[model samples]
Target chain A: MNPRDEILNRLQQVQRDETLPPPWQSRRDFPELAARFRQALTAVKGEVHQVDSLAAAYDLTNQLLRQMAAEKVVVNDERPLPNLPRLPHITYHQVGQEDETLRAFCASADAGLTSADAALAETGTVILTSGPGKSRLASLLPPVHIALVPITALTTDLFTWAASFNRQLPANLNFISGPSKTADIEQTMAVGVHGPKRFIVILYA
Target chain B: MSNPSSATMSQFRHSATVAIADIQLQGALTGATNKFVNGRITALTELPHANALRDHFKKIRSATLANLAHYLELFEERATTAGSQIHWAQTGQDAVDIVLNIARQHGVKLVTKSKSMVTEEIHLNAALEANGITPVETDLGEWIIQLAGEPPSHIIGPAIHKTRHQVAELFSKEVGRPLPADDIDGLTAEARRLLRTQFLAAGLGISGGNLAIAETGTLVLVTNEGNGRLVTSAPPVHIAIIGIEKICPDWDAAATWLALLARSATGQPMSIYTTAITGPRRANDPDGPEEVHIILLDNGRSQLAGTPYEEILQCIRCGACLNVCPVYKKAGGHAYGSPYSGPIGAVVTPLLFGLEEYAALPQASTLCGACKDACPARIDLPRMLLQLRQDEVAARLLPWRERKAEEFAAFVLGREGRMNFFTKLGRWGQRPFQHDDGLKLPVNVGDGRTLPSLAPKPFRQLWDEGAVE
Candidate 1:
């Protein structure tokens, strides 16, 4: 009778109340967390850019990779764009170099910088996570993603980022929030189907 | 898993009378349920307390279904201590033989799914194409109803009854030429270059859990076409299945059920990927899925736990009661033929299939109450569609002349002088079926619909001339 003990003995003959209720807090307050994360990440087309430091978020990530005429980007090496200023026809590809052609260079890259680990401002979202040198396909398969964040990593939603998790949790986290849409046609929307169609972020401060 | 004779009642009244004489399935079910009821009423009126977060997500789904076997044994012991591999099934052919024996012990030819109404309620792509394996469906409206083999008329727009010239004639017969049917961005860039090489050459990805949590065993998913993050991160074996009533109980009830599931389905305060996962890929993770596997199933949902339709297991499939269903806006979603259609598939496909094959899905609803006011977990669902029409007339399952006209109208409405002698013999037997004032009867009944007439002067003859004290 082991279908997991016949469904835990039919949920222990209908569990009466093993007491659980008491976690849902969110009254939802924002007090301008980066102006409500740039108005919920510019109403989901994303592209925030606030910048006040990290060298003006590395000069708006090299002016949004020369306005997306990108060459071959990639990035995510967990915080190290140091003395940056290269741009001799793009080509970056960082993420801790364990490389086996880093998933076909983040699937034929055209963009995919990174750095966020939190930032919700009531659903503009951007958590990320995945571990060591990041790279969940460098913010997923790239058509343009960017990220950078750190305005003390926002958070006023997804229940204050699952009440700021704990005991070391990263093994694929994500959240994301824009660019890679699809109204499943006839409902219309259509942006990059698989992932990034350009998300950007660069909050800084 | 063959059940699909479109859940009978003469194929739901011949597909609800050909979906009410199809004016393009009533303008694609009134423009996709009026754009998901005006984007779930502008994302729940810009969400601040949104009805106290749907009454705290209906008290976190009725306290996670009353300790659902201690949160599914703490989600199979923290998903087997965060490495995954859980299993369990118990029907729907033991969850399609535990995902076809984990795709025949990982030799899995091609899998790639994602956009799973519990794998279309366990048909599991016709048992993985009758064990030959192939699957595919990478979301763009379940790959336009899996290249038009059909089924999936709409539980989240599964080809919202196909049109864009029938999805450019089912994607020009899956790319063998002739494509442009008003090019929706050239048909989503030819379905993103054919599902990005079937998410980088599938080897098993499956997917289907929208919320499973049990304090960090995790699972989540959501999506908006990153094909649930390339079917849980580009396959190397993933699995998922789900539905032991989507357990919750932690991470603050999976953050109030992901803040009312993409603002009650597609209003999108979220869903452009939510992901989550929590196991199988931890060794300094670079990518994910190094064999995850979840399953859990329990096909009829463990006989719906302390029943009273256990709040229809607090559904979070979030089609928002098929966008405020007026009988799913004129019998659409393929006329509730079931992989869940409107009004929680008319009280969950007749309580998980049977009440004599979905007794015309609780008589296809009209009890209104707009699906418990577009349920976030409000779920009365017209009191479970009047307790499944009193369990389909205590299982006599109607029609003996509609149970003798509902037992002679409940014995003349339980007698007040036989309800005023059948209301003065239905006003003298409907005065020879009055014509211009309305009841043009002579047996056409309701095909053309008029039957109104009975009020002409009989409020008991204007309350015996007191007219209306």
Candidate 2:
């Protein structure tokens, strides 16, 4: 059997073991699916405001990164400091073709753009998974990473989140909220010490 | 051959003891953990249904583990479909052997590695070196400890114990010249220059997965410095070693895990770089590894299925428990002397490697229940620790001295009718053992730190004096 068939089979097995009705089978059609999603989105309403369109989100991330740089939150001087501006300098390179993208994006950009899963209003987190075209580094290697948000990807809670997910993703899926950070230092809140200090949700029109 | 592991553990303890007393270590640890704990608190507070979300993940983990075999099979199939090769190892050594074989097949001489604790568990570096291949650590923290020839003290902050001065010194020695003062930028520059060379020179790259999706065979790597990207992309052949239990059945499930992992660890809403490697380079692809191999190691994790400790496998290894653990704060990871250290380590070490070697580890905790509170997957760590302690006692592993103390204490408490007499007598009799501050006289545990002070007055005395209503 192919991978899709195998995944469906396993998911069916889990449903059977849990004695849960097949979620898809129980729903009559698209209307029910839409209703379920509506409920999920409603639950995540408070978190929704935190999500911004891609461009605006990048601005927010850059602002945070610049502030952190000024505060000496991160101590890397080998790379040129990112120059803050109203808009993030956008660059596009095919996933595998570009090696400089990782370095240029890591050292220079405020946030790198990639595709996103539905915007989660509950946590204000944008989801990205690895696959054929999306370079996994585009989401992670920058100072402040942003993803172009898809409206349809929104979920209210974790269960709702799982419902939207394909049982088998190609290789990797990452759910990002805002910025990369660690409290590994003396428990002081230092942004962007190791990863992006700020993460932003970019809602695409 | 000498037992490198035991010797390593001993040396680890020696360094940790020195680190524990170091003001810098204390400052870094206190600062990092408190910020993480407090930030998570604020984030969780902001989420209206945070408790409900925690419950949901618990349900998922329970349900998932119930039919894990099915999940694994599905995951293997999906991963294969994505043009990835998946191999299984029954043990750590088996996992290492598989990785080594892959390295040899590719004619790998020098391997640049991102930090993977799973690889560390099997002593992959030493094993690879013994076989005549060199593995270099690319993460700044991991590289420092690698130079120091020590195990990581803090999982997330591998070099948390090392001061900036020490880092500069290490870098200076490497360059055969005195570097600048202990400045963060200077230190980072030295590391970047050195590791950049290795990244370009490496024949293969090895990494550990933060999460592995069964649905797509995607390997998720969350990093800050962009090192994971390099290690995965720089080399022609890439091998990722992950524990089988790291699997989440689908992207949605994996995303939820990431939500909890990011927030619980370091209080990040999202990690800077969460890399997902799907398969080897596609026909049109330019920069990824030509051959991608993912080695999934069961290594005793499967044995945990259908057991109460099954929840332990749900851990994303965020080190949140370690951060909040009071015992861990004092004793540190080195004192635990296991690859997996802290609260999770206390439970997992005995389970994975056997309790006999790590008998002291479970006893290390004060049953504070902080670990349970800190767990994102909501693993009932305190309860598990208690169960392990009972098992120790049942198995006659509890020290005779402790058993005797318990017996005497039980006798005193059991004789309720004579409690008053003993209470009065004990109060008077314990005077000689009391210190100036009314703490018990200092007695040695294995560690050098002094025991916490005991109370001067028993609660019963205050109650008798009508100090309590």
Candidate 3:
């Protein structure tokens, strides 16, 4: 049976057995709720941007693609990785065009870069939701992920700024903060153990 | 039926100690906690009015919890009105029975579950498997652990202990392929494919409620994975296993808690999916479950109400305390041996199971008050821990060595005359053992810093020697 039919049958069974509750309706002030939610998210993300500008700008999709580039270093419109001492490579991936067949992409080019449409300022986290040609794995599986973020998605407090994302959500939404790290080994802080060794974000005006 | 409470307590003792010493556990904990704490601080800086918002949430929560019964009644009424079934389980066994009976009646062969710590605590998966129903874990973290045949160590990041290499290996075996070593995409795709099949074919979907509004009988689940939304809406049978204390009086109270929970646990202002399910699918509603069952499991929570530890119920199970605890860092969640691990686990496991079963957990703390500081609801963890210690002492459950040491210290301090003599001798006699730098010996033996190094001369001797007035 289809999912709907299965659910209907189950509901009917519950009804017959007297196990289900009496039906009730929800009354919500949608407009007011939406407005307040938006206001809160805006404020929160704005503040988060101030604390970690680069992290707030990361777009997981582009970050993953850039890291996969050939040269082990990708420089987008945002700028090149800082010299020093410790510079992780960045690569780029194409949107909607690339074959989803490639299991992994290593940088063929010296440096690749992809920019983000918006950044969430709260917690300096980058938001990456999945869609057509936007592989959710790209946001996660890469070793060093970098995102170029637009300044708009920044908010100070999370609750203040969350309302803007009311648009239909992707099947998966990943909120990434900093590089994947763990202190699991003897309480010593070690970064890039699993997800990413380094995470860089490039924010633009 | 056998009570595993006793066995659980012993396991808790062994694991908690190991957790205290495990360095890798510490690193994982510290990394997540610092990120969260720092992230929250940054987030708060943007909301200068956050204190006011917090106060509003606190007030709302207090009011909701105060009239929890009323809200729960209303919720039941409304949810039934919306064509949903609600069942109350006074204990864990009852909850398990309710879910099993439903599955049996339907002749369910397979069930898909989202991440619900409540199910873990009650060992629901095992129960289903014993009854020949294959229960699959749909959460990424949960799925990995299920493949490894272990319980979750961390609440938020269940597979936090696992390396990508480890995950790839596990997934590769499951998929029967020689997957690439550094292939993150391959692993994720493999998991997604596997879970989708489970999702589509499952006869039952069981989940845990983040919040249950009593007045509306609405159950809310906040998840990042579309799995949660799917688990409840796609499956024919949806059963929610929630603790009795999870009930909030109204939608306003739920909103207040949700506002803080996602942000606190994941730094998300709002989770990707915030589903408020009131009842079974409506006639007009295109999607949602047809049958919805909420099993309210009291377990051991009601016994704690109005007790000193009752404040623990206010905990939203955000796992923030575990993420930040220094001890939990060393000891992974398994070390706690109970479903609830870390500082909160330390207190709750024993209280729920009884003191004799978990005597060692009370002494597990360094009493640094970090857990208490990190708690969103201000569950005075250290105070509760100390109280447990006191109770242990009253019950004469204190280890003999500690009891003897305490008695000796008390006796010495009880007498002023002997104390004065001892104090005088303590200064003069310890001169030979004193180091030039005035540092105590590092070892526990007499050769080491067995006693506090005292001054070469007594206070009176200093006066006699004209070193003091």
- Provide the lDDT at A19 for model 2: 26
Q: Sort the predicted structures by TM-score, highest score first.
A: 2, 3, 1
Report candidate 3's fraction of native contacts: 0.00
DockQ of each: 0.27, 0.16, 0.04
Residues B31-99 of candidate 2 have per-residue lDDT tens digits of 656766787787666555667667667766666776666677777887788888888777788788888
Assess every candidate by TM-score.
0.35, 0.74, 0.67
- What lDDT does the true structure give each of the candidates? 0.81, 0.65, 0.61
DockQ of 1: 0.27
Name the runs in model 3 displaced over 4 angstroms: A1-205, B1-27, B414-418, B421-469
DockQ ranking, best first:
1, 2, 3
What is the Å distance of residue B411 in model 1 from its true position?
16
DockQ of 3: 0.04
Please provide, for model 3 over B97-159, each residue's C-alpha lDDT reduced to its tens digit, 9 standing for 90 to 100: 999999998889999998899998888999999999999987777888888887777777677
- Cα error, residue B252 of model 3, in Å, equals 2.0
Give the TM-score of chain A in candidate 1: 0.37
The clash count for each model shown is 0, 26, 74
